[model samples]
Target: MSDFQPAGDGSGLRVDLLAIADLIEPSSRVLDIGCGDGELLHFLSGSKDVDGRGVELSQAGVNACVSRGLSVVQGDADADLANYPEQAFDYVVLSQTLQATRNPRQVLLELVRIGRRAIVTFPNFGNWRIRWRLMAGGRMPMMGNPGEYWYETPNIHPCTIRDFVVLCRDLGLSIEHQRVLDGAGKAQTVRIGGSWANLFGGQGLFMLRRP
Candidate 1:
């Protein structure tokens, strides 16, 4: 097992979110798409002093964010991203929610159009463990809860780290920075966008900007 530990400042951010937070500058405008419970936003607001706004699809999540004094709205990324003005915020974050979107390419285009930079994180379907499991069991690999079946999972367009890198290139988005985490959420030293990273990385985090 990887000897990775989750990073937090008593605000309870996932390791991926902590990596995302590190890319953001202080006192900048941020729009977090699918900001569940505003945990990352709350962390950013407290630690980085950002003007954070969030859009969550679930009303329960929005309500929870509001309860924590966060500015969040209930909205869908597939349809609502088109309504935003061009370059409206300093950063736009879509963490682990890209696979669930109906039109990921269009959503990515809109993310760059609406914000100066975009931070995206997703589970790497090309991880060796996932591949090994599928080959050994002859079934879809379960990255999260093993009890949850494939049909019940929310991931529709789950892509590998290599797939994501190619998509960014095709979308004309420059990868400003990237981090690949091992199974235990530890940042790896492997070269970004390389085949080794794709095979070994359990999750991928990318900071993208339009060139």
Candidate 2:
């Protein structure tokens, strides 16, 4: 086991990333796409016995990761991935970033193509809170950390958990494991939590394998 450190924000790595790490084998190779500030990659490298690299579009994010002694490349996901050979990593991670891409499906396909397993996390658009907001407010719904001005929001392909699962089935991606997050960003417990996840969970984490 490696030493653990809190994420800069002190809440530690997002619960989704921690769950994904649990699924990964020790000393695995990981590539994190759209790795803002490389928090997840840094945590995995330091605390999970994984070799990690990050691809980030923001120069500031890239610089921050590099300064932390983490390997990172400054490039867009839509473009940078083309340079990596097929199956170059054990796991390719896309956390909280799939919705921000201009081409979510294409990027997801690329992730699976470039790695044996893919870990993906994203905000759930079909949460009951969001649904209620849309139904009563007549506007795009916002909640938790995603609340922001429409013009400034990074989510380009916001989708629901059901939408994501449907897409995976349509694309022939097999889900290996999954978890949902509550409003507090903690993993929702099973039992009743799954029901809430199906209706009101704020985010989702999935481990996918190509079929």
- Using lDDT as the measure, which candidate wins? 1
Give candidate 1 regions above 4 Å deviation. 1-5, 8-11
Q: lDDT per model, in order?
A: 0.87, 0.79
What would the per-residue lDDT of candidate 2 be over residues 24-120, giving only the tens digit for each residue? 8879999999888887788788778889989999999999999999999998878879789999999999877888888888888999999999999
Worst 10 residues of 1 by lDDT: 1-10
Clashes of 2: 0
Q: For residues 1-211, could you state the per-residue lDDT of candidate 1 as single tens digits?
A: 1233457456566777787888899999999999998988999999999999999999999999999999998998998988899999999999888988888899989999999999988888999988999999999987655466788777778899999999999988999999997765657888777899999887898989999
Could you tell me every candidate's TM-score relative to the true structure?
0.93, 0.88
Clashes of each: 0, 0
- Candidate 2, TM-score vs. the true structure? 0.88
